[model samples]
Target: MTNNLLNENYWTTRYLNKSTAWDTGEVTFPIKQYLDQLDNKEINILIPGAGNGYEVIYAFEKGFKIIHILDISFLPLKQFEEACPDFPKAQIHHQNFFEHIGQYDLILEQTFFCSLPPILRSDYVKKMIELLKPNGKLVGVLFGIDFQKEGPPFGGQMKEYRKLFSKEFEIVKLEPCINSIPPRMGTELFFSLRKIQ
Candidate 1:
């Protein structure tokens, strides 16, 4: 799809039509394991393009008080609010990710990057640099293989990902994921990159 077509209206329409095949209905295993190991619950965390916000909810329930969720479409944010009523309403952001401003100690990525048009990949790297605190981390999974169809769920290989992110961030870990859900088993890469000072 064209960049213009991937706006709030398009995503909102997807939610309205219940067309979200990407919604796994729960936190995926790789991310869940990563969150489970985080020692600091007090760190500032952001989950942008957080559809239905399963990870946000999981973090909050685990005692992470300063977590935030952002989505371009208000529909998923509304659903997130309904699902997580006690999450601070002020922390729920309804805006474009590129327009968002905040410094996070940790930013959780799930399907957000692939959903963007490939043309925005550089912008995404720049924005991650802008959004992170010095030495901050960006962690989560990305598709490690190409798909046969056109995509809102676009895919890429580790070499391209490393090339794209390594200039501004230290590639702490970027490897084929061993813990993906069955359907995504051989297709995902779990990554952890730290912002360079």
Candidate 2:
């Protein structure tokens, strides 16, 4: 059932048809700012469901080497490789995030969570926990508001997120995104959660 929503063919078709409205064409300001403040350039990082991956490019430009870019579809990964020809080829994984394996010091979430169907939220959280090293952090933004329309960019709120992630992560910061882009302002939550042992 869930596979039907996130089926490889479905997302691949979306990219092929240019139906991904979630492709911002640029990294969101909140995520860029979050990366700007992180000084550790060598930490192992994973960006799952990384479509277009503007943020990953931004991080790489700033000297992060151990970054893994994972996505379910091959289209975006190919595009990413074209854009960053020198990016480590081995780190670009064309696979399902749930099936992929790795321990990372950080995982960056941009619009990935909202892209999944609502039913997979719990599983998403569990997979995130399993991928992080002890005390590893997950940082990024989430939609603070919901879209009434059916979505590849689904919507969620703090209450549901807290309940879903609290079992394996400490919600260090879950609050309104004061610096969200004008279109996303007031509708976004910037969060930084640390994995719990």
Candidate 3:
């Protein structure tokens, strides 16, 4: 946690004050499309930094039962509980992403990576590898442009992301996102990486 501003209290306060502009209020298009094409319903899944658990709701509704949602801020988790009362309570985790320990068959990356200070990007990659089962996939979208201001929505280019992730995972898909939400349209990269055996 080198970035003091990214700690739990900071995020909790943002949620408390309704400052979460990163939230789209729905599962973004790229992740939803990726999940729709997956055939397996039994694999264990983890979504780290799962803000409102929108994707968790989508996955659960689509018949994926073994899903987990983790967040540093309990505020959103509490709201998520209210939104999906039927989702198993045990599957909702309030914890730091780096401190979480579990093996997952799939790890979905949403806005989590960019929310951290850019210095923690390598730690994020290493932790993703540690959390995944052998051959497990890490899939989702990343911002493809460098932001003009300091960012919880920090952004980076494709070449930098590819170089960073390739150290631990086999780069499977790292390209411009064709299905991003309108505001994010040309600025997002859809990616899938497999943990190296």
Candidate 4:
């Protein structure tokens, strides 16, 4: 990870100090719309880099119990546990996303990708493919504009993201996010990519 780009301690400290500006504090619109259309409740789902875990709570409340939440820092996981006490303790994971071992039918990407070094992006694509079951989908939002500053919320353009993710994932959906929150309205892209067979 880049020295300036927030890694485990950087992110953990953000949570510890309640300085997580990236945190939406609740499920955002694009993901919420995606979840609303889901007809199956039995598919195994995973959300890595799951800080605050509002989406996990959203899914759990809507009958999606076969969900796993992972984070590199335990701080946010602890907060999530308190926020949703009924969620299974076993489902909360504190570990690196690349090191996590599990086959998931669906993996939701929130703010995780941008938090790492830009050089790790390709590896992120490959690892997402590895963690998924055949035909499993990696669905969520990505920043669509490059930030001028060094970042944990590092951003990139659509063409770059499309090229990076194409090698391992079939580009099923990668477009400007129409339903993002006000602050993120024009800067986010909602994507859904399936592991290539």
Best prediction by lDDT? 1
True-structure Cα RMSD, model 4: 1.4
**Looking at model 2, which ten-residue stretch has the lowest summed lDDT?**
1-10
Please state the error at residue 128 of candidate 2 in Å: 0.7
Estimate the TM-score of every prediction. 0.98, 0.96, 0.97, 0.96
Ranking by lDDT: 1, 3, 4, 2
Span of 10 residues, lowest total lDDT, candidate 3: 1-10
Cα lDDT tens digits for candidate 2, 1-197: 46765678888898999998778898889989988999999999999999878989999999999999999999999999999999999989999888999999999998889888888888988899889999999999898778888876788888988888788889999988999888787899999999988
**lDDT tens digits, residues 1-197, model 3?**
45555588989999999999989999989889999999999999999899899999999999999999999998999999999999998899999999999999999999999898888889898899899999999999999999998887889999999899989999989999999999989999999999999
Supply the global lDDT for candidate 4: 0.89
lDDT of 4 by residue, 1-197 (tens): 57534357877777788888889889988888899999999999999888889999999999998999999888989889999999999899988888889999999988888788788888788888889999999999999999988776889999998889887889999999999999998999999999999
lDDT of each: 0.93, 0.89, 0.92, 0.89
Error of 2 at 134 (Å): 0.7
Off by over 4 Å in 1: none
Clashing pairs in 2: none
Q: Pairing residues by index, what is the TM-score of model 3? A: 0.97
Clashing residue pair totals per candidate (backbone < 3 A): 0, 0, 0, 0
Report the Cα lDDT for candidate 2: 0.89
